[model samples]
Target: MIIEKLLFHTFIILAPVLIQTSLLEHHKWSKSPIFTGVLNGLATLTCLAFTYEFAGLYWDFRYVPLIIAMVYGGRKAGLIVLAFMLIGRTIMGGDILFHGLASAVIASLIPYYFSKGFWKMSPVKRVVAAQFIGLWPIAIIFLMLFVFHLPSQFLSELHSITFILQFGLVQVLGIGIAARLNEWMVEKKVMREEIIKSEKLNTLGELAASIAHEVRNPLTVVKGFLQLMKRQSKGEEDEYLAIILSELGRAEEIINDYLNFAKPQFEKVERVHIKEILSEVSILLNAYAVKECFFGEPPGG
Candidate 1:
């Protein structure tokens, strides 16, 4: 009979896990906190409907779903699912109804705390922590059974170590499976985000390289004219023409850097002259004086 009960609970516990994993793979519901909560709540209710009975006492892997909801789904999801489980258990009206409610609360709280640092732990540690938190409710239920002695058969099973061990084993297996599934889902999400970010960067790099190439040709023509103007200018105007030529050269260097995205290995390795670069950059506003004279309406007009 104990073996039969174990087998029954095992199926009940594992079925929801499989369903949850499938939903995670195929649906966008996991991205929304409210939807995730609703999904978990429904799963808990379904598991509760198939409660395992032994020695006139009933229990289910309901808490396993609740724990998963809280730990992976966040506080709002946990609370929402807990409320659903409470309502369902209230309707069920069994000898252990209140005991089950209390156990659910404990189960939810345990994982809530564990989740604060859950991702920091190694995979093995995560599984161990999940199993421990999952089995804690069972221990709580046992204590309630012992202290209340309402079931009458509670005392009979109170000293049965085999019963406790079997239940613990079931909790460990159920919670471990759920935890691993949650970890896998998290890993897949992170990998997907990374891929998306990499694609965006690649697209931006290509766009930048294209824009830089287009701008460089016009800039080169402008620099050639400025150089010719510098050669023709006299003393006072010579200084001004030199500034314009240097500023145009700096602009070309900037465009060249942008183009380097297309062929980074061919980047210029020569040391840049910091003073010359700074002088060109500093005189950029003065270069605008020449630009205004060139493009703006004549001074007399």
Candidate 2:
């Protein structure tokens, strides 16, 4: 009977993984905060529904789902699952229902506080932390029962070292398995996305490089012509050629930015002379000024 119940509880605990994988495959919002809350909420309710009794107190791995919700999904999920547990257990009519709720509240806060950085934790640390949080709630509930001087039968159950060890081990292993499964799911999703993104980037880079090199050939020819013209032309014509050359230089700079992603090499950063940039700006503005009649044959033009 014990083995059968343990197998049943394990099934109930792992049910979410199959549900989540199906949801994700169908592009549903399986990882959404509210959705996680609801998923774990249903799991906790299932746990509460099938609760067993021993040691003169009701037993369920309700905290297993609750802690998973809090650690992986944050406060929103924690609250939702807690609500489900509270409602389900209340309907079940336990002798110490209030103790269950009180211990949940006290233990839940600890995981919620740690949830903010839980995702950043290493996989092993996350599993360990979740197990610790799951078991801590039971300890709190036990202490509460002892402090209140539970009826003789309950106290006697509490004193059974074998039962305490068995129960504690169950909570620890339950949470550890659940946490590791969740982290594995998350990592798989990330790896899949990276593969898709890399493929798209590779296609884009090849297309861009082909266009850039074709475009650069004509730009180079025009630039050479403009430079030669600048050297030979007089006064006003020389100034105009200088402006054209500066504009061509800027166009080449932009083309280079696109070509840098050609897969052979990446973008390079180089110091640009501000004074040269300012000189180009002044030349363009002067040409505009002359064309707008702000100057007729402006100085140096």
Candidate 3:
């Protein structure tokens, strides 16, 4: 038990450091690349310090550092760290099948709380929910022990329920911290978007003024041509009148568009097909096409 316990704790303590190295060395965490590097270096050293004093208690306590890495860093960072730790633990001949598996599975479950889809949710709520969900394995472990009545030498109770409860509590705390980190990251991203949008709006204002001035000449010509076409057409040609009216309506719409662009407001954002928009523009301008090719280009080139 002492050897197993020593092996577990040492493995857990070094897990974060090794994982951090992996991330930094491999350049995996792109959101804050430098942050991952520095943090990994610092965390590895910190865990090394903790291992000297608490080496015997490491196995049961490994989750604490795992949770810390996840919270202080992010879910992706946490997973990388956890993977390193699991591999390290397995290599050290500690908790390879059951305990190791449990820890890895539990660690994997932590990230779902702060996944991209869950970004809108509060981190605290996500952590609480994850803790609740993650505790099921502990329950299952206990039931298995009870049903099988395992040999005392190998699977003694050893304050089993109490230890499991403690493990759950530690995990909950770790997850809570991680969620806060995610929230901070989200707020920063929102602020960045606002800045970008403000700059875009300013640029749009200048462009709108230029567009309005340039479009005035075309609009006037269009109105004049519509008036001439209407006068030339016989009164019975309803289709010609309809075409002229639509052209005039489009001119009016362009005037409104200039006003809107000048003092732009937030527009509804939705998915649009670029090809469809291009097709619409082509159909609108079909009347302007000439039979002669420009620049003396070969036909169909």
The candidate scoring highest on TM-score is: 1
Candidate 1: TM-score? Answer: 0.75
Better of 2 and 3 by lDDT: 2
- Model 1 residue runs over 4 Å out of place are 1-11, 14-17, 23-26, 113-126, 148-159, 264-301
Model 1: which ten-residue window has the lowest total lDDT?
150-159
For candidate 3, lDDT tens digit of each residue in 1-301? 4344444444544444444444433343534534542444344334434442221223244444444445445665556656555554555553324554564566556443544444354657655654554454445444544444544633455665445555556545544444444455556667878999999988878887778767876777887776777778876775877777787778768777777657646578788999999999999776556433344568777
Q: Across residues 151-235, which tens digit of lDDT does each residue of candidate 1 receive?
A: 5665466556577677778777878877787777777778988999999998988888888898999999988887888888878
Spell out the clash pairs found in candidate 3: 9-58, 9-59, 71-178
Candidate lDDT values, in order: 0.75, 0.78, 0.53
Query: What clash count goes with each model?
Result: 0, 0, 3
Query: What's the ranking of the predictions by lDDT, best on top?
Result: 2, 1, 3
Can you write out model 2's per-residue Cα lDDT over 204-292, one digit (the tens) per residue?
A: 87888898889999999999988888788887897788788889999999898767745485469789999999999999898777777
Cα lDDT, model 2, residue 44: 82
lDDT for model 3, on a 0 to 1 scale? 0.53
